[model samples]
Target: MKRKKFASLMPREALKRSKSAPTIVVIGPSTSGKSTLVYVLVNHRIIGFITVGIGDKSQTTIIPCNFAFDERIEKDEHFAMRIRIKDFSAKDVHIEILEQLAKLFASNELSTEDTLDSIDVEWFQNILEPKDAAYHLGKMEKQISIEDFKESIADVLCAIENAEPSFSERVKVKKKELAQQKVKISEIRRMVFEDIWGSISDDLLARYFKWLDYIGENITNNLNLLLGEDNSLGGIHDYSANEDDIFMYGGTILQTLFDPFEPFSLIVEDITLACRPRTEIITRSDENIPLRFCLRDTMGLTQIGMDSNSIKDALDIALNCSPDSILLLMNLEERDDVIAESCDAIAEKLSKATKLDVPVNVIFTKADRLIGNLVNKSNKETVVLKQDDYDATILGAIDNMEENIRGYLTKLPQKNGMWLSLRYLDEGIDPIQRALKNQGSDKFERFTPTGLYQNIDEIIRETQKRILPEGIETPLFVTAIDADAPAVEMKVEGKMISNIFNSIQNVLTEDNSVVNGYTITTKYTLSGRSVVAYYNKLQRGQGHTTRANVYGNFSINMKAMLNKILCNEIPDFLTLYESQVIGTVVDNLIDIELEHLVQEFDKNQHYKDLAFCDINPALISKWSDKQRNTQILHQAIRQYFSSSEKYYMVMDKVAFNLSYGNEQIRKIIDGVYQKPISYDQTMREMQDTFKKIFATQAFSAIIAKEIGDAMTDLINKMIILV
Candidate 1:
């Protein structure tokens, strides 16, 4: 994409030549130097003032005042000119003069002072000589034709009424024409000088020039209307007075005193009595007279009656004025609730009404009051208070009066509104001054090194690690104890838990790759089975056939794999089981509480990294009498399953249901010599039982499928080894 070029700033030459002027609206708390500043800027002239009234009554400044320096000039004895300065800046003065000079002059070469000085006796008398003046005035009156001057003068006299017209009458007519000529000359001269010299001027000239410029520009643009306030000081009790007296005594006797010729900058000590709106009194009767007053008119600076409410009206006016920035001056010394409330209300309304996203700075006018209260004061260094501190004190006060003034705005169900900041201007550094300096800086960038968004990111990362499950592949099951007895109580035997955890880990990590110096496919699932002997028989009976089939198919395959491992076909299990025994001894070093034992086991690296191992029941019988040894092994397995808390934990973690209809199958197997049960019937019954178990517990079906796949893989490896 092509980069766009930046627009050039307005040239000084163009600004000088431009006829328009900018308007500045100054507002602040009652005595915060608004009017004083305006006086100084206007060449120390107090052109306007605002009266706030005395005591409990509220008073306002009304009417817009225009101040400018007028220079009068004379051209010849008959003509005089008035040149009014229109605008002023640091560079030069802009002025308006008469228009007649355009007829005789092609170039503007005459200065105002030069033009005024040139009006000496010769030029005056020469232009006003009897014959010449008569001829000129006649031409002006269209009384005599240039071709027949003599005859036309006689005819012009005949048209005059019954009279003896004097020579001075003609000269009087000539004077007016001369005055018109002087005005024209002045206008042309001003235009010419401005064209050449631009508006550059010395300090004194610059001040007056700017003053005049503001007046003319404000008047033409209706800015005065925007700044004007209502001045009728009508008492609320006016109707009680008699009709005749009402007209005389209804309004307050106020006067709007202003010095229009004064300069822009003048220090004003007290505005309360110095400035007042003008008023008149009327009499209705001897005892019922009342004061009458006129509503101050807007000085064509702005239009009146733009809105229904005063606040909205003022806001509309402010927005149109397009203030560079707003300074909300609050007087902290008075601690006046009403004054603060009014300021807040105005600020809120202005923010809502304005088009420009103008920054508003709330300046606390009397910060010296809080100087003594500051703790942790930095004498030589600038103190920086946290946002919370400002919100607690300054904002808290505003919120107290206007309950909805603070952060309550965010709770409202609305979108796309202005954002505001609550601040205390402070004694040392003025917030408004800082705001003016950084008016257009990035709002989101933090002034301090740290911010809130940085803290939120850290919290979210910690939460993610705690909740997501972790493993390397599919068909993975996490072993956890699932015990139920309304809550079972058991002494935590550290050695037993650690042995179980390490045993599982050893099985899972065991290498099954070497057999006859050949690499074999050796992979196993690290799984845990419940050792609790007390089973839910009712649940088992409901799905007897289905459970039997599952045991015969899946569980039997897993059992076969264990048989191979136990028989030393896969020597890794021998080492794994041996390690489990040794690890159990090492576990006795730790202390454990029963409630905490479950979580500790889950957190253990041994349990998390454990691998599966297969075991054989037949090996036990072979070591002794087949029947007696088999019974002993069965009883031992039952006791282990029944007594170990880890048994139920593994069932829950793996989501396994071990109840199967093996009792009937056992009976048949025991009576194998007496009555032979068909293989078809037995296998069919097992399949039915497995299907019923899966149908009864859908979640168990998910675990069963995963276990089945793992078992199948293990069996295939064992078969290959055999």
Candidate 2:
């Protein structure tokens, strides 16, 4: 068989160029199907080129991979990122460190000064060796030595031949056609040596898999290890897969095991995800709003790294990328705890802890899977669910999600969450309402956003009976992904994604709600059925085979959502999140906590390393300088916030902190009150020291011991007559 040329990575020169277009960074937790979604959007240009690692357990992305589908635009301007920046040190992953970075960025502790002058592109170039690993894996993964593989094959055939379940009888009793392949395993291997090169017969493939299924669980796991993929996700014999999908399946496995990006994700970048639809949605009263924006994916946050973080360089990158919007993807399969973590992490990264940062959308992926699970569970005894029951079940699931996020998604402090409302309304008021007020009604021609909010409420009241509880106030949508769905379908989705970019662009550009530049459009969908799936049950089902179509509002959008929540100069935020500010007050509190705690006298440096006589005057000056102790106790706080944009930290050079406007941290005197680490204890120690030196210890010790009455003798010696 002739081999096709394998897809390769974009060149180093291409990777070094910075993005110029308005970017949209896609971020999500691992297994959110992020890479697969990207592949479907770009439609197949990337499918054969990069392995998306669909079925593996370990992480596959390494750095931000910028993807551009447009030939006219430079590819360097847009990026898909896994922002676990630094060297490729996978074992050294520090969620706390990354969280601290995010927190510092959000709280303004980190800055560009701490960043490397430039990303080391040369270092990134060296990781291409994974391609060779892929080659070997795709070729050698199918077999052990000839004898061992034959023995394994024989074992499966023997099991079938002497079947306890009577396999041949079952195949015969059913009307199922038997596979005609009579060949052994060795005969099949000659047609293809690599996984991606096959166009083999299904009958022959089935026979091979049939043999594989006879093996015990322990043996199957060992075979998976030999093939160089993790067995945790699945065994080597995945019966659920179609016979032809083996090639892509093999590619996913190889990518999981030896993916070039895995090491790179450990470093500072990520690479993957592209697609923007050219379609438009008709607004209320019939106006077309187009969708046009670049997509980028970034490193996912760990459980801890999502909510609270302090970092600077990541913020600098954010400023550099200057994305017009942010889209966060969440897997519906995640536990409730993970859902909360994902939301908190995103809110913090966008610099809004209480709610999502401005111009952001939360997209829930895998909704289809969630629905499938619930349906399957219901069908366990009988495939029974009425239309109302089905809708109610999904609503309950969404309600559970809302409940988990109630703490973080509280009502907006003022303005009913239209708080810090846009100072300038960009989208015009509805002409119909204005005309009506001008003609008949004198009072209802609302100029403010008050009318728009009221209009939305009326629409929701009229449209659907179910709405998420009022307490969960964040702008949220749940959409299902099909990974390979058509552009028209856009996953089990069509609406939210189609409308998201247009709404965000409007917010960022004009701070407005409607695309028509008129009043907020009442025509937008508050909730409606956009996902439709037709499925038939297996003919073998005892409950009787049936075909039915399910309609769901799986994809939802709240048009102009960002317009309500986005405000760059929100003073309420400054006051509400003041605890995040780290400056003189915070630093002083840190100092007081860390210093001033008095150690015992024997553990003091001047006493521990030397005897009383060993400390000469010069040595005493050095220790008081004392020579006894090595000073392990250092001044505590680093990255003191000096302003909203800059932070100061302690470092090697006294002047190093000055570069970023940081304060110079003075050295603390060991076991003494140099700078009060603990103010009260240090003062008590000072008072004791003052009493011993000038009040009592100043008198001769030998004379006091010799005298019967020390105080009387000392007073008489001083001046009896006086």
Each prediction's whole-model lDDT (CA): 0.25, 0.28
Q: What tens-digit string does per-residue lDDT give for candidate 1 at 322-347? A: 23233333344344544444554554
> Whole-model lDDT for model 1 versus the true structure?
0.25
Residue 181 lDDT in candidate 2:
44
- True-vs-predicted CA distance for residue 125, candidate 1, Å: 53
For model 2, the superposed segments whose C-alpha errors exceed 4 Å read: 1-18, 52-56, 71-293, 300-321, 341-358, 373-722
All candidates: TM-score? 0.18, 0.28
The residue-by-residue lDDT of candidate 2 on 474-546, one tens digit each, is 1111111221111011011112232332332434345433222322233221111010000000000001111
Predicted model with the maximum lDDT: 2
